[model samples]
Target: MKQLMQALIDQGARLIGLVGLPPMGCLPAVITLTSPFSPRQCNESLSQIAIDFNQKLQSELKAMQTDQGPTIVYFDIYQPLIDILQNPSQFGFDETNIGCCGSGLIEATFACNVGSKICPDPSKYVFFDSIHPTEATYNYIFKKMQPVIDEIIQGQ
Candidate 1:
């Protein structure tokens, strides 16, 4: 990470944003794979791993952000996403466990297609496929990140 940052700095890059990992256990794919019977529940083990990684990453990023080259910003999408998943109705999301495409249990990428079954409203789902977030979910994340982005831009 330090090397990459230096490389970017060498090329005249100033501001850098690093996104934290989402709760992988809450994703449709992980739930389907690890807790098929209890689809609504997320795999806590995987979620913990992501959480730990995010914490470490945040710490590292903070250490990297000196008066040296670039201003490294760590964008935490984990908490906001988890908040939405825990309270779907708050974010206008009806489905937090399953995705909008196909069975929403395991389908992803090319597996989601015209032939595959889809939810009536994609906006009501947190995930578009098994692993990706829907547009609405991304909108929420973007809004949450807006303040930080504004601060970075204003500072520059």
Candidate 2:
């Protein structure tokens, strides 16, 4: 990621932005289909990893925020996913587990077709696919982060 950042710098990139990971618990498939054998992430290690990763992301962004470099940011994907999962009704939805298309409770995939079980409206779902956010989810994320984005881009 650092090397990529420097490469972006070399190539005259500006205004770096990121959309980060959401909480794992809220993913329907992750919750429903995840391997029980898969051990829970060690808190000590996960915390360290989060700290290290955040530091690195910040370092890379700060490095690029120099006079001749772009202002960079790591979007907070964690909270939005949490908020959506915790309060789907706030976003005009009644369910978070039900996807807008694909195999509903079984799987989420790109094979949405004529008979696929699509939700009534996509605007309310937290995720569009089994693993990705829908347009609605993306819009919500954008709107939620708009202030931070504006602040960062505005050099505030």
Clashes of each: 0, 0
Q: Which ten residues in a row have the lowest lDDT in candidate 1?
A: 32-41
List model 1 lDDT by residue over 8-127, tens digit each: 888998888899999989999999888889536899899999999999999988887878768899998999999999999988999888899988989999999889998899999999
- As for model 1, its CA RMSD to the true structure in angstroms is 1.3
Q: What are the runs in model 2 whose C-alpha is more than 4 Å off?
A: 35-56, 63-65, 152-156
Where is model 1 more than 4 Å wrong at Cα?
none
What TM-score, to 2 decimals, does candidate 1 have? 0.94
Q: What Cα-based lDDT does every candidate model obtain?
A: 0.91, 0.65
The positional error of residue 36 in candidate 2, measured at the CA in angstroms, is 9.4
Error of 1 at 149 (Å): 0.5
